[model samples]
Target: MYADLWSFALSTYARPGCEAACLRLQAQGADVCLLLCGAWLEQRAVTVTAERIQALKHIARPWQTDVIEPLRRVRTQWRAMAQQDEDLAGLRERVKALELDAERQLLGRLEALAQTWPIGNAIDQLHWLEGLAAEDAANLDHDALQQLRVVVTNA
Candidate 1:
């Protein structure tokens, strides 16, 4: 049931209509949570308090592992390679290739992560992925500068 709820939320979030679509999806997700919570409370024969509801929301927010470690390692390796290369012409192409490949991997990983996040704010999750992408891009820019310097000296 949770899986179905999450899938619906994600699809609804992705659909392009207007502001109304987003509102509708959020309402549906929250309603499902309420229904599940109600059933759980009824089954347990316990009164649901505000704190209990908050706890349910917390559980629903599902945590996703930050995917920065692999990206960090890739960036560090690229930085080292850029610093060590003497010929810019030969290494420039390779450097560009590395950045391109890293970007591709980053997007794929981020999208995969989004799919796993709980059914609250997939939009916020997407924004967080964008943050990781932006930060990674900056690291690439710095690495490229180091690479260019090595190239200029050898040329």
Candidate 2:
């Protein structure tokens, strides 16, 4: 189990079905950074409380809205044009990289915020996820979320 957020994100995202699950959740307005943070916390057997979940989201929301989402929007918006324009494709690739960097920075911030939070005996694997994505969780693609939870818990 990886304790480092970035490393855990990289490895867990590379797992089969994990990327698709993440993208699905992302499209549903879930914060991927928080999802990865959830995975890391689960790896360490942290007990999730509603207050702690809100604290994590509070840290992630601003950066995601102000930084990562814009880069992602530009990158995604350029997809069709990028198919026909080499210059735009290059620019889109760079934007994609920037988006990744933005997420990395967000993860760093999340790690810092929870660095001193105590670990607990019980593992609330889905609580973190639900807290972050509660609205969509009600109508989520259950299989995909289950897949993500499996990856999150290393199950």
**lDDT (Cα, tens digit) per residue for candidate 1, span 1-155:** 22332333333333344124223322323222222233223322334344544444343333211233343345556665667675643465565566445434433333343334344422322112112212233333333222322322232
Residue 130's C-alpha lDDT in candidate 1?
A: 15
Task: List candidate 1 segments past 4 Å from native.
Answer: 1-87, 118-155
lDDT of 1 at 118: 40
TM-score of 2: 0.91
For model 2, the superposed segments whose C-alpha errors exceed 4 Å read 123-126
* lDDT scores in order: 0.34, 0.80
TM-score of each prediction: 0.24, 0.91
lDDT per residue, candidate 2, 25-141, as tens digits? 888777778877887776677788888888988888889889998888899899999999999999999999999999889998999887777765665455666666645577766
The most accurate candidate by TM-score is: 2
Candidate 1's TM-score: 0.24
- Candidate 1, residue 14: lDDT: 38
Q: Candidate 1, overall lDDT? A: 0.34
